[model samples]
Target: MLDIAEELNAWAAEGRDFAVATVVAVSGSAPRRPGAALAVDAVGTAVGSVSGGCVESAVYELCRQALADGRPVLERFDDDEDDDDEDGLGTGLTCGGAIDVLVLPVHAAGPVRPVLAAALAATASGGAVALARIVTGPPALLGGALLVHGDGTRHGGFGGHPELDDTVAAEAAAFLDAGRTGTVEVGGRGARCGSPVTVLIESAVPAPRMIVFGAVDFAAALVRVGKFLGFHVTVCDARPVFTTRARFPEADEVVVDWPHRYLERTATDARTVLCVLTHDPKFDVPLLRLALRLPVAYVGAMGSRRTHLDRLERLREAGVTERRLAGLRSPIGLDLGARTPEETALSIAAEIVAARRGGTGVPLTGAHTPIHHDGPLGVGSPA
Candidate 1:
């Protein structure tokens, strides 16, 4: 749902009522992840996707039903084609998997509008926000939602009971801090153990940042690739003429400062990526020294094997430990025999994807690896 937050925001601003169907859980080889959403507005307009195509009509009808009743519903779709006989709606997915979707109606005049507005604003402003909704609970509590900001401020209400609301709020805050999106089950004095309440915590975090150091032609091409991969890309160079926005039109930011100094004062998280396109020692050595020490997801530099060795020695002299040096991906990008700037950018983007998803940068045809490995039911998915 957060993926289409802007569209929802427009509807909310116009005081329009709409319903959303969000994929909350997946099993086996589902097409989409947990946060994938499909929304339908009052006039029957739809946006976003949940199954890529399969089962959309059923989900859309469910959204309309939810909008009409002012209630929420949880619908499950399986890959077994035989199941269609039971539902008569042909809601079975052909992806040979199963998914659970929650159809929730958002009222423009309801208490949740402010929270939705906040979430939409956060997406644009590069802040983090979490939205928690009750998917399985008593009739009065179902579909209840609460919004929590990074600074601990909260809006909206849930569960009707203060104890229940407090418990869910605390849990939502914890997940928000971790930047995780998933479901949590609660049952206790405020909620019965026999009948548990499941809450879906959806976190809308800022796009993972991709800092491209050196505004060369390769960097300009890579900036477009980074943005296409849903990153907030920034191109930086000490040279004012080369670091202009006109050169890298798609970059979210163009910084005209020394690469090392810019990185020293910028903020980064585990999902952030640092790409050093400047192979020169004057720019590469200092910036890499800081990049390697940080906790970002990827740190790669473009250079030949000999250049990499020289850069490594310089970084070592600058006090970067051997263990930290192991994190660097020098001569950055996969070996694809790339010659053009666009081709080189593709290689780098491919390598970045491989690193983030734990792929081996090898052909999958002969490999025995699972086609999907990030889902909850994937072979090595986290417990």
Candidate 2:
């Protein structure tokens, strides 16, 4: 939903009516994740995607239906079978996967508008927000919604059951903290078991950070790629003349500070990526010593084999352990034989993606692996 927030907010400001269809759950080899969404405005314009193109036509029709009915809907699409089109409308999944989608009608003047407005505002402000909807519940409760903001305030009300609403809000907060979008099942009494109520929590947190510890041409190239890949890129260097925003306009920020000191003062999480592009011993040694010990998602250093070896020795002497050093990907990027800065940036970006998505960095043509792997919930084991 955050992916389409800017567009949706524009439509909302224009008082345009629209409907949103979000993939709430998936099984088998689904192409998209839980937060994937598609929205259709009254004029028949659509944005975003739920299942690539397989189930889009069907979901778009559902969105139109939702807008007309002025209510929310929970629709499921499954792998195609001989009898899958029994309904005669031909709305069946062609892909070999199953997905559950929540379709909600939204308008400028409606019960759900506040939630949509709040969601857009949260993403715009770079704050965290989550929306929970009853995907599977009693008829009256189905599609009931709640919005939880970063400051513990809530917007739309949930199902009439107070206990269930409280439980869903708490679960949404936990998922927001973990930066996850998934489903949670709760009982009527807000406990773990009873009459099942599946709440689909869609979250929007600030973009993951990519901090490049060098203000060089390679850093500028990497900043452009990082921004294209949806990261909040920052270029930091102690040399003020080299660390100007004019040099790296694509970067979200240009920090004129020592890499290690700036990193110590910044907020980083498990999704943050630290790139040490400064191959010089004076800058690389201490910056890497600090990065290797942190719990960041990826830490890579740009250097030759000899430089990497010397840096490792310096880090070990600075109290970085063998296990900690293992986290570093020195001589960074894949074996792309990249000579230009743009190509090197591409290789580095590819390696970062492969690491995050558990890819092997091998050519798919000769390898045997799932074409579409499991998503956030870890439903299907990777092949």
Candidate 3:
């Protein structure tokens, strides 16, 4: 699957056959979402995970079986009370959820290997691509796949009907545009007359951006955290001497331009996060004036209470609206009583994640709220 594309791409480059088990659907409280996968090579080596360890062994065996038989298999694992085999050998999820996995082999002579390999390569290189596979359909088309690139070009087909291939490609392109990985239900043969087919479209897009507008020590630590959270982090500052690649090696880019000037020219989207660690009013005021108006996911500034109040007055004088100012997270990061740079960076990253994931930034120890939230406040929510 595209989730483990880097490793699987290497396997394909080496001409090693492997079986990939991808989660096509889930019901209830499943750990992994659609497109999560686990792959096993012909030599018994495994990489990646489909269920975070709950149903890994069973899925591993399924991958091995798929590799041996050269046939695709769809298996469902669910929590069943009737089963008494409690040695942990049962494939049920301990979280009481259900997941449907589709296992397909990628042998050297397989018809779909080239398509899969091309998808893997594109995904590993951070290019936009989508892999659409038939999760539920006729036996002949069960594991058929199509690779849709960002430019709307495609490779491979279901081989069932041209209409079906066309329909899936369009649907996959839509998913790719949205950077989503999930399933779409369509009638067999691309019309509503026959049995329904569920196509799992796995989309891979470049990571979202996290622009840290200060080359301070805290920014260094924050860059590491941002990378760990799968962000394309950039560190920007006006001072050339302070903003160097050596100071922030983990950052994807180190830009030596005035914060506001650089941000004006660079690109940002709803998923982009802006962190203004340059507490100086000269830098913070101009940069934040532009940042607060942009349609970005988060905009936080690092400063003390007094500094924040003064900065707010300066922004007010700079013609920023109250509505726009409300979006700023001055004194950035949750109140963690953090003193060290690393701890402060952790707190800042925590607040960013909380905003993106719809968390309350409160202790979960005594809270009765749902551990996972899937509402409008999720990633890419209105900023």
Model 2 spans > 4 angstroms off? 81-95, 373-383
lDDT of 1 by residue, 213-325 (tens): 99999998899889888888999999998889889889999999999999999999778889999999999988998888898889999999999999999999999999999
lDDT-wise, the better of 2 and 3 is 3
Off by over 4 Å in 3: 81-88, 375-383
Top-lDDT candidate index: 3
Expressed as tens digits, the lDDT of each residue in 166-278 for candidate 3 is: 98999999888777788999889887567999899998888889999989999999999999988899999999999999999989999999999999999997788999999
User: What is residue 91's positional error in candidate 3, in angstroms?
Assistant: 2.3
Instruction: Report the C-alpha lDDT of model 2 over 1-383, residue by residue, as the tens digit.
Output: 66688888888878899999989888877888888889999989999999888778889989999999888888888876335555654655676779989998887788768777778777766778888877887877777778898778887766467888788889988877777788989996688888988888877888888999999999999998998888888999999989998899878999999889999899987888888999998898888888887888899999999998998999988999999999899899999989999999999998887777777788889788766643332211110
Please list all clashing residue pairs in model 3, or write none if there are none. Answer: none
The better candidate by TM-score, 1 or 3, is 3
lDDT of each: 0.83, 0.83, 0.89
Find the 10 residues in a row with the least total lDDT in model 3.
374-383
TM-score of each model, in listed order? 0.91, 0.92, 0.94
